[model samples]
Target: MAKTTTASKEGMAIRTKREIIKLLKQEGALDALQLAKLLGLTGMAVRQHLYNLQEERLVAFEEEARPMGRPAKMWRLTPEANRLFPDGHADLLVSMIESMREAFEEEGLEKMLEIRNRKQIIQYLSKAPSDLPLKEQLEALAHARTAEGYMAEVIDNVDGSYSFVEKHCPICEAAKVCSGLCSKELEMIQQVLGEDVDVERKSHMLTNSNRCVYSIKPKGSAVL
Candidate 1:
């Protein structure tokens, strides 16, 4: 068996830190004890990583009030931590969009986006199951987005609807340069999800939020 060297141990620590960040990103907030449980590590080990992340300004914590002795510390990712995820050649995409606009004007640029939107709709439709339950269909949609570096997931809402959330937008910069890209995403999602359901944009990433959320449900009925 290969002996673990100092460098290898250090590498494991680094990987643990990243895993902590991913968990926080997906689950929103968690206490050190909770993180330790989920990661199969001791609380002390988790807290050490959390403190390092805090010092790096990649993570922060707020105290949650408890009825018992002491309040619990709930850790969450800081906005700066968003850099760790992929942005899908954001700078290059943004430059290409600007070049297209300058060469062809707004109308031509919109036309190009429309073509891209049509392709995107077809791609999503090809993967998302039309015959499954609305929630399961949304799960498939989320899986497709995740494969495209969107870090997407579906959540069950209390009001009988599903929330499809994209934690990271790989084309965020490009989307900002061309608002139609953002609208097209919504339009494509609506079309791909089928006419039997309604998809509503709830939160937007460009509006100071780090995530985009959409409320989806069957038309004139609950999802489940």
Candidate 2:
């Protein structure tokens, strides 16, 4: 077995911090209390770390104006802090992917590659029992992927069509590449559908970037 290098660990740590940084970027600002709650840590603990972050100019806090009460400070990323984070999927997706990566004790690179492997998807969904209807089967597939840290959602596109969207891609932003996550998603979808399905992606606005949406035409639905 090869010994893991220090750089690998550091990379994961940065990825983890970047994960937090991603959230800050999304919310645009958060007070120490909010950060503590979001991270499930005590306010003091978050404050301690943030103190150093402030020194490094990665974060800054300012007292907010309040009526009839002491002003509270809100924490937010500085311009420097923004530079430290990778521009990846929306913060939710980044956090989810990072959480899953840590939970599996796997390197982010390896985890992403494994998830993208076409065969793995086919094998997993193949385990679903055929007795379930297509919608139920699709939900099962989405839920399974969600368990793996992907924010997967299936939306009814109406007229008997379904839209499949993967709202996060951890590897995409890290590597500045697509990593074919969408392709793998489509593959699993086809396996579940058991036939050619009309699928297309829609134009999306921010607040949820890097999301993949596929419009599906389920079998035997007359509406186009």
Candidate 3:
């Protein structure tokens, strides 16, 4: 007979919590029942973990209306939980931007933004080629963005259009100080997708939306 060892309670709890966070990041707000179904755990068990996370201010819940009854509690990661994900040295990046602004003013800052965009365009183009189908290009671009801590994904509209969503922005703090950083990202995407493709910023986190959503479709068609 083979003997099997079970994970320690503490270790299991930690891993489960991380999984919960990962699911929420990928799928957005979900109720305990949804989470339980996804994680294959009892709803009670998931609720316990969620309550614990709520106490830590890592997660929060809002009442979401359902057609049948009272609103269900939909849970999501709090902004504080952003620290648990890769941040790409947010503080240092913000500091560098501030220092550059002090030394060079708006003109110098704009120049730096251009330089950074050129480099990012090169890197992004290598991953996502315009020749590929639009869906394939988005997947490649999302992969590259996720690798850089953007937590990006592509959403199929099923009507010959797609949505490029970035759930979290690792350099959000830096972007806040330098709006050009935000605009240049769109430029990079435009350059990668080529002129026939239309990439529009539908929603932005800086505008108080939960995430950044870009409407992408071929030119000469409505953005359904």
Question: Which candidate number has the best TM-score?
Answer: 3
lDDT of 3 by residue, 5-104 (tens): 3446767888889999999887889999999999999999999999999999999999988999999999998888888878779899999999999999
Sort the candidates on TM-score, descending order: 3, 1, 2
- Residue lDDT tens for model 1, 1-224: 25668779889999999999999888878999999999999999999999999999999998999999799999998878877888898889999999999999999999998999899888877788687778877888899999999999999888888899998888988988899999989988988888887889999988966589998888898444
Q: Could you tally the backbone clashes for each prediction?
A: 0, 0, 0
lDDT of each: 0.89, 0.60, 0.89
Q: What TM-scores do the predictions have?
A: 0.86, 0.43, 0.92
Task: Kindly report the root-mean-square deviation of model 2 from the true structure over all alpha carbons.
Answer: 13.0
| lDDT of model 3 at position 155 | 91
Worst 10 contiguous positions by lDDT, candidate 3? 1-10
**Candidate 3 clash pair list:** none
Candidate 2 residues lying further than 4 Å off, grouped into runs, are: 1-118, 126-131, 178-181, 203-210
Q: Model 1 — which ten-residue stretch has the worst lDDT?
A: 1-10
